[model samples]
Target: MNYKRLLFCLFTGFTVATSPAFAFQELQPSDDYIQVSKEIVEILEGTHYNKPSINDQISELAFEDYLDALDPTKSFFLQNDINALSVYKKRFDDAIKSGDTQVAYTIYNLYLKRVEERLTDLENNLSAMLEGFDYTLDESLDLDSEHYTWAKNKQEQDETWRKRLKNRALTLKLNGETPEAISEVLTSRFKNQLKRIHQTDAVDVYQIFVNSITAALDPHSSYFAPRASETFNINMSLSLEGIGAVLQMEDDYTKVVRLIPGGPASAKGELSPNDKIVGVAQEGKEMINVVGMRLDDVVDMIRGERGTTVTLEIIPSKGTGQTSKRIKIVREKVKLEDQSAKKEIVEVTRGDDTYKVGVIELPTFYSDFAAQQAGDKNYKSSTKDTKKLIEELRKEGIVALILDLRNNGGGSLQEANSLTGLFIPSGPTVQIQDQNGRITPLGDRDPKIAYSGPLAVLTNRMSASASEIVAGALQDYGRALILGGQTFGKGTVQALQEVDKGQLKITQAKFYRVSGETTQHKGVVPDIIFPSVFDTEKVGESSLDRPLPWDKIHETRYPIYWDMPSLFPILEPRHQARMAKDPDFIALNDQIAEFRENEDKYKTLSLNENTRIQINEETEKRELDRENARRAALGLEAIESVDDIEPTDKLVYSKEAAEILLDFIAINQLAEREKAQQEQAN
Candidate 1:
C-alpha cells in the first residue's frame, strides 16, 4: 500500500475521544488549528529548503519527536499506554497534510492524563517518600532519558519517581536547605506545576504538535501559535524588556539559545548559549523551580519592567550539567547603540620593540536600515564604523589590527559583506544558495580598501551567521588570519511566513563561502585555534537535532591579498609554544580537560546524599585549585575560595590576538625585505 494513501485512510473519519477524568482539562483541537496545520504543511513542502516528501518515514520521525516533546524525561506514560498509541504512529503525515489533527489531540490528551496521575501520586505520598529515603544507600538516578524505556507498569514508574525525588532532596540538602525548608520548597514547586497543568489549552497543544513535525524537518524551523506570534513580534519590534537572552525548550529545560549582543545578560557576561535555566526568581522572592514548566510561563516569570532584577539558576553548558550557578540580571531595553562596533588600541612588547595594534570589537553586524533607506548619510553601520575606526588607527600609526567577533551572534548580511570589503580590494565575500538551486555571489563592488595592513579576525563558538560570512570571506581572500575556536555554524537562513492563523519560521536558504565550502554545520575553522570556554558538543548548530549538513559548491573567482597559507607553518609553531607556556592558557586547557573527564559521570546522578556531596565538593575543589594555580603563576595573590575570586575584567583574548598580530607583521616584513635583497642580487 502507498504510505501516503494508507495514512490518509487511517485518519479519515478518525475522532479523538474525550480526555480521561484525571486529566487537567478536556483539551481538544480548535477549528483554526486544522487550517493552520494544513498551511504549515503546504509551506514546508513547497518552500522549505529540503523540500521533504510527506511519507511514513517522516510520520514516524515526527511521532517520536512529539512523544519526546510531551515527556522528554519519560517520567509519564507507561509502556502499555505507548503500545496502545503506537497504531497512530505512521498516520501523522496524512493527518497533518489533510488538516486532520484528531490523532495529535488524542496523544496529547493521554499525555495530560498520565501527567496528572504521576503528579497526584507524587503529591499524596511526598512525606512518605521523603521519610523513606536512605541517603547512605548506594543508589543513583539516570538523568539521561534516552537511556530509559517507558515504565512497564505503575509500580515501576513509582520506583523511578522515588529515586528522582530522593535525588532532588539530596541536591537541595547539599545546597544548605534544611529538611523542613526542602519539604516546603518541593511542595510549592509541585503545586505550581499542578496549577500550570490546568492552564494548558488547545493552542498550546497544537503549537507543540506542529513544532514536533517541523523539528523533524530542521531544528531551526518551528510553528508559532497566535499568542506566541504576538510575543515574537513584540520582541522583534524591540519593545519587550528582559535579560536579552534568546531561549528555547530543550527537553524539560529552558536552554539559552544565544545572548543578544549588548543585552543585560551579554553585558553581564555570566549567562551564555546552551546554559539550561532550571529555576527563576523575582527580586527578593524565593526561587521557583522551572525545570518542567512551559516556555511561555517561564518567559512570563523572567519578564519584568526595566530596572527590575530576575535571578536565574542555570546549569552552565561549559561544565557537565551536574551542578548549577545563579546569575542575577537587571531588566533593561536593549539599545541599538550598545551593540555597535567599538575600537581600542593595545600595545605589545616583543623583545626590544613595542608594536601598536588596533582592535575593533563588533558585537553584531548591524545597520540602521530605516535611516539608510531614507537617505541618511550618517546612518550607523558596521562597515562604516569599522572603516572610520581603521582610518583613525592608521593615522595613529598602528602596525596591526584585530577584529574581535567573539560572541557576535550575527545580524545584517549586507553589513557582513561590507565589513569584509574593508580588508580586501573588491572581492566576492559570500555566496547564497536558495532552495531552487540558484547561487548568488554577494561581494564588495567598490575597488577601494580601508586598511590593508597586517590583520587578524578573532572568533569563538558563539560567533555565527553574518560573523561567519565575514570571517570566511576574509580567510578565503587571504586578507586576514582567522583566530579562536570554530564558529557557531548557523549558516542556514530562516524567514517568517504568515500562515492562516499564526506564522511559520522556515529555513529557506544556506550560506557558503567564496571557496565553495558551505558554513551550515562545519563553520569556518580558525587559522590558529584558541582554548575555548564553551563546550562544542553543547553549543553550535551541529549540537542541534536535524541540522542541515555541510557541503561545497563551485568556488567563485576571487583574488588573494596575502599568502596566509605559506605563513601558517612559521606562525602555528610559535603560537603553540607560547600557549603551552602561558599559565592562563594552561589552566584553561586543564579545566576543559577535567570537564570532559566528568561528562560521563554526570550523566547519572547519585541518589546517595553523601556520594552526591562528595562529587560536588571534588568539582569545586578542582576549580579553586585551577584558579589559584593560574593566579600564582601570574604573580597574583591566591584566593582562599572560588567565591572570593572576582571576575577578571581583563581582555586576555584581545591581548593574545595583539601578540599574534605582532608576530605576523615581523614575519611578513622580514620576508618582504629578503625578497627585495634577492631582487637587488639578481
Candidate 2:
C-alpha cells in the first residue's frame, strides 16, 4: 500500500460505501443536543454588527448543495423517489432544524440503509449523468466557470481513479478477505509493510479512494461506509480517546501534525509533529500491519477508551529510517482545562530594575458547554480564567502584562465580550447586522474592569475572531499597546447551527466592530508590525479562486491609540535598528533559506533498493537548525534544538513564533508606560 499511490487515488477521486462488521445503534437523541445547536444558530443569526447577507446566502445554498451532491437522486428526487424523498426531506429538515443533532442522527441512519441500496445499484444502473464520466458541465448545476476546469481535471483524475478502485475491488473479492482485515492490510501497506503480514495494499487504496471522492464534493461531505460513519460521529462529538493527535494524509503515510496536550500522544514524550503512523494492535495481541491503510479504517483499529493500551507502529519523521517501531500508548479524553490560560513570568531588565512581565498565553476563549450546562460554577471560560490570572499577576507585583492572542482562533463570543469588558468601560464589544439590514450591537454591561495596569497585547496572523474583538477593543480604548505580526484576518463570525449538528458547521453571519468595520479580508493592523514568519498575506479567502470582496463601512472610534501621541512611528525605528543586528533574526533567514533549498527533500525519496531505506537520520538535526536560525534572526534566543522550540499544535496558527516575538513588544510596553506615568505626573 504505497501511500503516494493512495494519495494519488484520493486526489483523483474514487468512492463507495460498505456495510459495517458491527451494526451498532446510534445513541438515543437528547434534548441537550437540540438546545446547544439552536443556541449556536440563534447567536450567529443575531449578528450585532453588519448586514451578513452574504454569509446567510452561502450557508443556505451550501446546505442544499451538499445534500444534493450527496444523493442527487434523493435530494433532487426522481419521479419514483420524489414523493418519498420530499416527505423524508420534511422530516429530515424538521430533525435538522430542531437543533437536536441526536434526532438528525437517527434520521441519518434511517436513510443509511436506503443509501446503501443506491450505492449497490450505482455500478449497474447509473446513467452518464450519475456516473459523472462525461466531462460536459451539468447545465442544471450552473457551476462556476473555474469549477468547470476543476471538473475537467476531476474527470481526468477520476478516470485513473476508477481503474485503481476497480482493481482493488476485484482483487479483494478474488482473495475472499474481510473488509476489516483488508483495512488492516491496506493500512500496513501505506507505510510499506505488507511482506510478512497477511494482507495486500489494495484494502488501504480502496478506503482512500472512497474518502477522496466524497471529499471532492465538499469540505464536510465525507463518503464513509457504516464503520467510517461511526468514526465520524465520534469525532464530531469531540470526545475520543487515543494519543490525541490530529492526523494528516501526507502523500501516503498518515502523519501526526498536532498533539492534543492532555492526550497520551502528548504525554508519551516520544511523539512530535511530522511523525508518521505505520501500524497498530492491541497490547498482547500480535501487532496488526497498518502502514498504508485508509485513514478511517486505521483510526478504527487504533482509537479506544481511557486507560486502555493501544500499540502504535510508528515510522518517525526522522531518525534511522528504522523499521516501524511499536510504542504502546494509553488513551484519555482531551481535558479542555489543560488548554486553558497559562501564565509565564518574563524577566526583562532595561537597567538595574528588572521587570517581571506577566505573560498570559490564551489559546482560545474556550468554554466547555457540557460542563457549564451542568451548573459547574468553576466551568472553564477564558475571561473568567484570565480575570483570575490578572489578579494573580497583580499579586506578584508585575510591572506589565502581555495578553498573548497570537494563534488564538477565537472561542465563546460571551467570553470575548467579557474579556473586552476587562478593558473597555462596559460598552458594546461588537456589532452584527443581518440580511434584512438590521444592526445589533453586542454590549458589555458588566462594570468589572480587571487589569487596568500597563498592558501590551501581542497579536499575529493567527489571532482571529474573539482575538480580534479583544485586540480591537483594547486598541480602541488606549488600554494596551498592540504588537506582533498583523492579526489573522478572520473577521467573519460563524454560527454553528443544527444544519446537521456535527454533520456540518455553518457560517451564518459576519460580525463587525462597533465602528462598522467587518474583520473580513482585512485583518487588524497592529500599532507596530514585526517581521512575522507566517506571511499569509496571499493565503486567505481573498486569494481563493472565487471569494467575497473586501469592503468597509463608517469607522468606529474607540478610546485607545486615537489620543496617544505618535508612539508607533517613534518606536518603529528604534526596534528596526535592533532587529537589524539581531543574531536570532539572522538565523531565521538562514533557516528559511535551508527550507527553500530542501523543500524538495520529500520529493527526492529514491525508491531504488538501497537509497529508499537509508533515508537520512539527520532530518531532526536539520529541522532544529532551521528553527534555531529563524528564531535567532528574529532577535530571539538560539533554540538549542526542536526541544527548545515547542511546535504549538494547539495555537490557531504559528503562535510559537508569537511567544518569542513577545520580546519585540518590550519597546511598545516601555513607550506606553512612560506616556502613562508622565501623564499621571502632569
User: Which number leads on lDDT?
Assistant: 1
RMSD of each: 3.6, 12.6
Can you write out model 2's per-residue Cα lDDT over 1-682, one digit (the tens) per residue?
2343344234434222243432223224445445544543343335323322224344344334433433332311223332323333333233334543332333233333343333333333323322332212221121122232211233443443343333332233334556555444543442232221123222222223223222322232223333444566675455887667767554345777546544677667677556777667787886665544446667767778888898887765533332245577887776687668888776655568666778788877877777889999988888888989998988997766888886576777888888888866777778765545556778788777887666778887767778888887677676777777677566655433233323233344566776667766676777766655553533333432223345555555455533433554555666566555655544454544655565445433222322322333355577677666666555667766554665432232123223333443555567689999999999
Whole-model lDDT values for every prediction = 0.85, 0.53
Report the lDDT of model 1 for residue 613: 68
Question: Over the stretch 450-550, how does candidate 1's per-residue lDDT look in tens digits?
Answer: 98788899999989999999999989888899999999999999999998888999999999999999988989999998888677877889988889999
TM-score of each: 0.95, 0.58
Q: Where in model 2 is the C-alpha error above 4 Å?
A: 1-238, 245-299, 309-330, 368-379, 460-462, 485-488, 495-504, 525-549, 561-565, 576-586, 600-682
